[model samples]
Target: MKKVMLIDCCVRGVHSRTLMLAHRWLAEQERDSQVEHLRLYQLNLAPLSAQEVEQRKDTALGEQFAQADEIVVAAPYWDLSFPSILKVYLEHICIAGTTFHYVEDQAVGLCRAKRLVYVSTAGGYVGQRHLGEEYVQTLCQTLFGIPDFVGIRCEGLDLPGNDPEQLVAMVRFG
Candidate 1:
């Protein structure tokens, strides 16, 4: 069975439509696998300080990320990107010589996950404004060695003249 790590960054908890979509999608993924749900809201993850960066201490967080066969991130789209807490988690895991390393002026990924799925929701359209999603996708491939990246975004949740519930329900993760 594949080991799945579900990183939930839904700041609004159960009220987050993005998280609702993520859970729905995960439920559909042939459930003969181990799934670990990590709620970022409940974690007291500290930002990477200058001392931490200089120290480059190995972390168990990096090991967890590297060992997962599938990594799913459910982070709500805010300010043209995902929440800041998710970034903090990334700061802790994306470590040098741990999650990745440099070799002869090139970077090599150490993570073992084969796929990365990103889920988000926004009140406005997030087509061209998906800067954060793009960054994460790129990082997954270059920094983490994840080849497949799927991004599912539900927009217009709070927009006028749009049925938020219908939009969410209409989306069938493929």
Candidate 2:
């Protein structure tokens, strides 16, 4: 069975619209696939201190990324970006000799995942200013060697006179 890693970065947890959309997307995946769900909020994740960076501890999260055949991330847009917790998670997983390694002058990804799907919801219309998705795409494709990248986003949820549920329901994933 294909192993999929679901990284939940939604700060609102069960109340997040992005989480609802992500659940729907995950439900549509192949029935035989195995999903390893990692809830960021539940994890005791701390940013790497200067000393920890030098020590280079092997993390379970990095191992999970290396083992997965595919990845999915769910996060709500916050301050034009995803939550800081997501960034901390990335920092933990993007370890050298785990997710990626240096090849001469270039960095090569060692992760087994071929694709990553990012699901997000925004309070207002971010439009072309969606930096969170762009950052993740670049990281997955260029650094993590996930060639295929997809994003499902629902914008304008907090906009005046907009129904949040209807906006969230518009998200479609294959």
Candidate 3:
């Protein structure tokens, strides 16, 4: 069976609108693939030590990330990016020779994923301020070798007179 890596970075727990929308998207789109659901909040993730970096090629996280057929990342916008924990998780999987390798002194991706879908929800409007999404999209091409990058976002969920449920309901997977 093909694998779909679901990296859940919704840190707000049961109250996260981002998490709510992510679940809806997953139920509708990823019923066929085997899902490896990773909740970032529950995982004891941390910044890599020098020793761990050297051993990353043999780590399970790196290998699984490389082998995933597709990737879905669910995170809310924070500090113009994402939670620090997601950064830590990314560092763990970004192993040389696992996710990427140096070629001619330049980094080249080695991951097997063909597409990466980034799902996010914002409180205020996020017109051109998708720093987090842009960062991931760049990584998909340059570090993960993913050809297709999709960004599905529901913004202004907390704005006055706006309904979060309606916004999430209106979000399209297309």
When summed lDDT is taken over every stretch of 10 residues in candidate 3, the lowest stretch is 53-62
> lDDT order of candidates, best first?
2, 1, 3
- Stretches off by above 4 angstroms in model 2 are none
Residues 31-147, model 1: lDDT tens digits: 698999989889888898899989868888888988898999998888898889988999999888888899888778888888899988889887765987898998987887788
Best by lDDT: 2
Per-candidate TM vs. native?
0.94, 0.95, 0.91
**What lDDT does model 2 reach?**
0.88
List candidate 1 segments past 4 Å from native: none
In candidate 3, position 29 carries an lDDT of 72
* Model 1: per-residue Cα lDDT at residue 6: 93
For candidate 3, lDDT tens digit of each residue in 1-174? 779988999877778888788788778874678888889888888799898866675578888889999888999988777888888988888888889999989888899999898888888888776999998999888887888998889989889999888889888877
